[model samples]
Structure formats: C-alpha cells, structure tokens
Target: MNGAVVEARNLTKRYRDVLALDDVSIRLSADRIYGLLGRNGAGKTTLMSVLTAQAFATSGDALVFGEEAYENDRVLSRVCFIRESQKYPDDFTAFHAFKAARLLFRNWDQAFAERLIGDFGLPVKRRIKKLSRGQLSAVGVIIGLASRAELTFFDEPYLGLDAVARQLFYDRLLEDFTDSPRTVVLSSHLIDEVANLLDHVIVIDQGRILIDAESDALRGSAATVVGPAPKVNEFVTGMKVLHREALGPLASVTVDETLSAAQRTGAARLGLEVAPVSLQQLVIRKTLINHPSRRVPGGDAELDSMEATR
Candidate 1:
C-alpha cells in the first residue's frame, strides 16, 4: 500500500486472432481511486483480469504489490475483484455469499457488510438466483465495499441499479474511502457519474492506453471558447483545437490547453467566452475515442494529439 499496488509490463492477451490487450504497460498507485474508462471491447475487463490473476496473459507480466499475482496467496488474499455480473453457485444465498467473503478476505468487515446490505435492501435469506438484477448488483457492491482489500477492482459493479441506488453506492464509497484509504480502480462506461470520484484516470481504447493522468490535471487541460470567428481564431492561435462549430459570424471551438489568466483576459477583451469542458466532453473531444480507431497510437500523450490523434 506504499508504492505501486499494481504494475503491468508489456501485457498482451490474444484470443486466437483477436487482440485483447496489446502490450499495455501501466502502474497503479497505492491508496488512490482510479477510473479505468473505455468503450465496449476496449479490454477494460481484460486488463483487470490480468492484474488480479483471474486470467493469464498471453504474454508480458502483471504484478500485484510488486509480486506476480498468479497463485500468490499473500497477494490474492489482499485483493478483491467484484465483476459487473457476479455469479454465485445455485445453492448460494446472499448470506452464503457473505460467509464466503468472510472466509476469503482477511479484512472483511461484518458490521460494515451488514450496513451495506441494509442500505442496498438485499434479502439475506433469499437465493442469489432469485434476486432482481438491482439486488444482484447490490450483492457485488456490498462485498466490494466491505471487503476493504488493499487493492480492489470494481468492474462496472452497478448494472441494473436505479439512479438513486447508483448515487447511494457512490456516496457510500466516498464516505467509507475517507476512513480507509486503499488502492481502488473502477471500470465503467458511466464516465461523468464517476468523474468526481476518480483521483486519477486511465482511458483504454482498442486494447491500448489512450490517456493516463491525474483527474484534476485532466479536467483542467481543456476549454471551450465561443465568440466571433476572427476573435476566436486570434485567441486560439497556435493552440490545438479538438472540435469546432460555426454559425454565420459566430464560432465555438474546443481547445486542449487550459486558458491562462492572461489568455482569459485577452478572450474577455475580444468578447469571447472561455468555459471549462465537462469531463465527458473533455474525453470525447480530446480523443474522439468512440469512433473508428482500429489501432492504438503507440506513443506518449500530448496536447497536440488531443485533436490530431482523433
């Protein structure tokens, strides 16, 4: 929990002709909540599986706590991976699952688990198969929150949950995290919802790293300027523009660099409005990641690429 809680070197997973992870290398910091974001089939789950040793990599290595995760009791016992669709045995009830959690995880908090169970309104005596989808998701969320592992990976663990329930999960997570700081990673397509929860972000696209940076830094890296076309052009000169929209004499452009105070003043003088882009829009405009990129750019991220790479 001091240094890198998880590290991968040239990690790759190939299922026949399909490439799941393409020589991806990353280091997860200790005691930080990281958002592992990407589109579907972007290898988010693949990366998690490799790191947690739930599945073997075709090539390269994954280390948990500076040691290989595969078959290492010392490492595995301290890690918890709750999948989006968790499967329990036919006979396993929610109570049975809790019992299993208590046996497997050394840091399992029964009282905390009970609280989460009540918060989620899970039926403890009912069979896992009999629970509704939201309740099923709650089972995973409950285990994940209560397990309190040194390294915990939640792979979209809130499917089938209503907006209110999802908000509850987020509130509970942040509240509990304040008391027990640990290495946590959340993989989700609900980017904006978890934007505030992330300390850092790592976006994967087509089995490759797209963007890896601190959340605040990432949020501050882009701005949208709207005004007369000429003034906008003059203000954004030499800056990277990710997207642009124009109507008659007016224009609005999304730029990769955060506006300096002087730049803001200049924009104000030019009658241009500079606005911060939302994390969702930032990711979308910055990467254009949702469309057409079969191969990952094998290079370091730069402001210039915020538009060009798309």
Candidate 2:
C-alpha cells in the first residue's frame, strides 16, 4: 500500500459564524494527481489553508510528511500553493516571481519554467500587477509545475483563461507530471475538464467529506437512467436513487449504485437508456440531493456570487 503524504484527522475550522471545516479526516497517497472538488463555501479552500499552514485549525490534526505543518519551514518550503489571487509584490515581474520560486523551492527547475513561459507567452518583463488575469494565472501555473514541490495545491487557478489557454495548461501539467511524479491536489469548478487527469477524487460539501475514493471506482459507482417515468421507476429497484427529473412523461434519474448485469439486461429489455454517469454529473447530482431546495439556476458559480469564498 502507498504511504500517506498528507493526512488530517478530525480537522475543523471556524470563522466567526461560519464553520468552515467540519470534523473531517482524509489522506492523499504520495505521487498522484488528486481532485479536490466541492461547491462554493464547501470548505475546499479552508482545508487546503489548514494543510498548507496559511490558516490554523480549530481542532484535530493536520500533518504533512508525518509532521505538523504550521510554522514548519522544512515542510512549508517543499509545498507550493497557487490560488486564483496569489499575491506578488508590486515591483515583481513574471521573471521575478520565477526567480523567487527558484530560490525557495529545493526542486525548482529553471529550464522547465523558462519553457513554460514561452508556452504561455507570459511577459517576463511586465509587472505582475499589469498582466491580464489569464496571464497572471499562467504565471502561477508555471510556478506550480516548475517548482516540482513534493506537494502542490492549485485552487481554481484558471479564473479568466479561455478554453484554448486552459487546455494548454492542462496539457503542459499532464506532460510535466508524467515526467516528474508528485502529489498534486487541484480544485476546480470545471469538473469535466480535469476529471481525466485525476487519479483520486475527494468531494467536500457543506464543510464535510461527501465522497473520497479512487476516480476509477467513483466513475463506476453510479449511473443515469432516462426513459418513461413508469418504466424507469420499475427498472430501478433495490438501488438508491440520487436524483430525478421529469420532462412530460419522460424521466431522467440517477441511481447511487452500479448497474448489475441483470439490471442492465432488464433496463435494455424495457427500452430504457442506461448511461454511465460522468464525474461532473455525479458531483452535481450529489450536491443537489444534499441540498434539495437550493438550486443553481445556471452552472456558473461566478455568476451566482462574485465575492470570493473565505
């Protein structure tokens, strides 16, 4: 079995009235790409902050490399956290940021960073504050990849990037990760885009752990069924249903169990449509089931609230 590179036990955080993190325990196996997913205010950022020592835990423990992470220079230097709004000095340019990272990170690769700068077309001479949002994000992505830290956390790093730019980031990260294997935890709202890159998936909802399992196992855990309401209902029995929607007589429902061979045969015989639930669909349906009344009119989180979650 793989050893835990990151571990937390009964971790909780409170910010005034907001209970940011509930009593949550989780572990990330070393040298793997893990997806940290959740809705806004799901404590995803809070959990990362506690693990990275940027914030304190109200209770329980957070350990990195079998040691407490807070104020621990040895552990801190080996970790890199690049969020959407990572701070840089007013005088700092993209090159300056890379230089700072090279000095701080023990495993920094200057050549890799330089190549990424070219790939992203980042203005090395331009001040960090002057770069566009996507360009600024590219700077962070370059650092996160080239730093080659033992543990890296990227919390929604592509805030204003277009599809082409986002795909470039994904491509470069995937390629670099294969060459330099390390533990990475990426948090993103574009679940489908990064789903393929994840070896493990951990979902947090309402300050609590909702789903934590191997990505392969999670993909096979649930399925969606679309057909007539009566037939879909009759075909799905002895299975936990996660969510359901009705369009006239036609119905669409997601079930919380893999389709057995017999179940698949039955569904096919009954002229029902049985499809595998995607990682994004599974997460969305689960979140909806968890909060029945709170509906997201659109899938975009930025549209709902421009304010950043603390």
Candidate 3:
C-alpha cells in the first residue's frame, strides 16, 4: 500500500449557497494520529465525509490507499468511521450490534470488544435506543476500537462521557496504538484533553485550512507575553498579535510568531513573563477572532470543532 493513506486534491463541496469546503487539499500518512480541528461550518465534516466515501464532493477527488474511496470495496473495507450519533436498529442490542460488526470487519477482535463492553459497563441485552447519550457513545467507541481497521476515524466519540470514562478511552486508545499502529484521526472539542494524543493537527477556518503541522511545532509556534501595558505593547509592536488581554496596567498578548534567541533575551530584559499557548486556546482565538463574521453553526465552537472533524 502507498505511504500516503488519505489524499485530497482540490476538494470542494457546496450546499446551496454555502460553500462547505473550498478547494482544500491535504495528505495524511499511515500509522500516525491526526487531530482534525476547526470551528463549526468550517467544512471539517464535509472533508472527512468525502475522504471516507460517506458523502461525495461537489468537485475534486479524494483517495484512500491510492484508490477512489467512493463505493470502492477495496478501500472502504479497511476504514471505519464512528459518528457521534451512531445509529443502530431500535431493537438491536449491543450484543447483536457486535455480532454484525464481527461479520463485517475482517479484523474484528471479539475478545477486545467484549472487554471494552465490560469496562464501559454497557449491558449486552440493552437495546441501543434505551441507552443514554453517554452509553450510546460508548457503543461507538467499542466498535471503532475493536474493528481494528487500518484507517479509523472517531468523530467526537465522547459526548456526555464523564471525565473518568473519557480518560479510560484515551488510555486504551494510546495503549492499543502503541501495540498496533494505524492511521487514527480524532475529531474532538476537548482540545486540551486530546492534545497530547495527536502527532499532527490540521485546523480549518471558513472552509480553508489555516494550520497543518506537527503538534509540537504548533505548540512552539506561538507564545504569550505579559507585563505592564506599555512594555508589553512595545515588545509586541511589530509581531503578529493573535489576541490580547488587559487588566489595568497588566497586559497579556498572544503572538503567532515564534520567538528567537534575541527576542527571548529581550523579553527577559524587559521583565516580561513569557508562556506557551494551549492548543485549545490558540484554536479558539484563531477561529473566533479571525472569523468573527461567521458564527459557528453550533452555539459551542469547541463542540463544533470536534463534530465537524468527525
């Protein structure tokens, strides 16, 4: 198989007057974890749908394993997409769903699926329709993990899950990833929660890719400095200030530009406190500040970011 697992070439999608995606192109490799991030209506969902063959693009092409993904059995069989609101027949119990999954997925691990079901405290006989939102999410998680597909996408898989349950999911995912590496794309609103799990991140805004880089590199790309208003203002005068906050004499400003050795020394000399910006905060500022004219479809921008990526 080719090293490039997912490839999009000038991908575009439209819904009536709205351009859901706009000439977006990206290349994702295998055996790595990717974070698909963007505000609501930024085309994150449209892009993933096109790549996974769940939905067609209005223009351009998407390839999975070097083959057209749309209705292509060769490519589709190796992929699994777990939607946030995954649907199961009203009468279908978790046990029945797993049985179906076992028949469909060549790599399905029944033992693993059973263990996950126990860990999540999901009742085998309970019909899917009777499960709570959190339990419903757990079913999707179990299927996605146990399917063992070479390419798996988890689109906001932890909705309504408590902190403890969410942590368990992350722990299991990381452990399994270490044992058997595959391409895993996670779309989540809890940026800080999954920040450490991602090797790479792709951020989209207004249907355009705004940032695509290694997670570590992105973390180091921006810095925030705080000090007296005048000094901070002087220090950030020519830099790309992404956001700024002021409380009387104290001022804190986040800059998009990386700091040089000379700049670091200058900040120290000026008695300015420099700190790193979290992925979540950076994304919020980027999407909200840069595109204020566009309100995220969902009231919650973070939730939209996670779901859109799915």
Candidate 4:
C-alpha cells in the first residue's frame, strides 16, 4: 500500500453463510476518481464499509493512507464515508449535520457547504427526519462535496435525487475535483450516469472482482459485429463473444476485444458493421455473460429485472 490512498489485501467478509467480499484485493492511487460499480448485492457496500472501518473484514487487511483504518484517528479524519441511508439524530437539522461534519473533517469548507445548500434548495432548518427523500439525499451530497476529505467514499449518494439534481452533483463534483484533486471512490448502480466522471473502474460481481481497468481503456475494449450470420460468426470466431442476438439471417455479436484498424477494414470488406460498445452495455453484458443463471432461457428477462432494480 506504499503510494496508494486505499488498498485492500485479500479482504474477505463472511456472515455465517453469506460471503460479502471474497478474497478481494485492490489498490487505489491518490487524486483520482474511481467508480466501484456492481449490481444490487455485489459487495460494493461491504467493501467500502470495511475500508472505512465501519465494519471489520473477516480476514485480511484494509488500509487507508498507508495505514490500517480501524481506530486510526489520523487516517479516519481525512476520510469521509457518505452512505445512502445516512442517519442523524432525531433533533438534528441539516445545519447540525454540517456543524458535526465541520468538526469531524479538518478540511471542511463551511462557505462551500452554504453555497451547496442554496444550490440544492435544501431546507437547512428542517429536521433530518422531516426532510423529504430528495432533500435527505441532497444533505448527504452537500456534506460529501464540502467535506473536502483526502479520501472520500460516496456510496449511492444520489439515492433519491432526480435526473437534474444528479447532474448538478456530477457537475459540482468534477468542477471541485479539478480545482482540488482527492481520492474519490464512488459506488453506484447507475453506471451510465457516473461513467464519464471516473478515471478508473472496478466492477464487482458475486463478491469477486469481475473487471478492473482504466476507464479510458474500457471505453472501446469491446465491439459489436453485425452482418449475415455466417460472416459475423467468422469475424468473432477467435474473440471472446460476450453476447449474441439473431434476427432472421442477421447476427449481432458482441466481442470482448479491441479490434485493430485492419480488422475494422476487413469487417467492412466482409459487409459487416462494427459498432463501439458503450460502458453501460459492456458492463451489463459482462455481468450477465459471466452469470448465465441470471438470464432467461431464451431472452433477457433477468437483464430487464436487473435494469429495473437499478
């Protein structure tokens, strides 16, 4: 964990029969935004919880700032963990939450917090229990941005935010991050929304790391080949086919390989259309392809189920 802001070595978390994190190891460098993405119960929350010391790993190490995070004031003070269902005292208001955060996080910016409150139209005087779902999420977003912690973990920080509010969060996050870079680990089910904000991505599935690579590298790492069934199948013969759909004689096959310029020209010559796979599409295909039980017998009924949950 020498130069890493956060690192986990063979981390495992098991609750009797359920294994949340299965021998997971990862290294997160400093001053970069990372997307910790997965489906509904894919150990994203468990990983963050262990890293922040909110929950202990059943085995192995969880380090932050080059030291074990549990009960380490020097490490914990520079870290902020804003969970989806963050709780506050019944009597506490948004103002009180900010006050507490300011005292907890040494780099807290009160002025920025005030500006965010106004931007979100949050009712600072309203009690935490009295605020609407969207307002509650806004409170968390404000604290996460204004805290300015060196290591921040935002676990579904846009839980109740609408499309507009979510966009505002992304805009502010990128703007502030450009001015003052920090290590940010964002775990969200909305992969497409936060895809552009991430420098690196670590996708988890069934308590294991499915894909961990730079975001730029992953963008065009896969391609879809479409043409007559025979030629399309031949084009993707040696490639790792992620998915395949057939409509009469036409076959569109998604392959997990970066095609060369010559390959693209060859496909065109063979009357095949090559299209770049989107980040969202790639993630879904990889996840579903790796787990066939989640798919319906002949269609994507379970894929639809997964998307609905997201």
Candidate with maximal TM-score: 4
Whichever of 3 and 4 has more lDDT, that candidate is: 4
Please give each candidate's TM-score.
0.92, 0.92, 0.92, 0.93
Candidate 2 residue pairs in clash (backbone atoms < 3 Å) = none
Q: Which RMSD values do the candidates have, in order?
A: 3.3, 6.8, 6.5, 5.2
Q: Report the number of the highest-lDDT candidate.
A: 4
Per-residue lDDT value at 230 in model 4: 89
What is candidate 4's lDDT per residue for 1-310, written digit by digit as tens?
Answer: 2268987899999988999999999999999999999998999999999999999999989778889888999999999999999999999999999999999999999999999999999999989999999999999999999999999999999978999999999999999999989989999889899999999999999899999999999988999999998898877766767788889999888888899999999999999999999888999998987685755565554544343232
Q: Per-model C-alpha lDDT, please?
A: 0.88, 0.88, 0.86, 0.90
How would you encode candidate 1's per-residue C-alpha lDDT over 187-215 as one tens digit per residue? 98899999999999998887988888999
Candidate 3: Cα lDDT at 89: 84
Runs off by more than 4 Å, candidate 2: 292-310
lDDT of 2 at 183: 94
Clash-forming residue pairs, model 1: none
Which pairs clash inside model 3? none
lDDT score for residue 236 of model 3: 81
- TM-score of model number 2: 0.92
Q: Could you tell me the TM-score of candidate 1?
A: 0.92
Model 2: lDDT of residue 73? 87
lDDT of 3 by residue, 182-296 (tens): 9999988899999999999999887888888899998878899999978988888767667778888898888887899899899999999999899998888777755756444
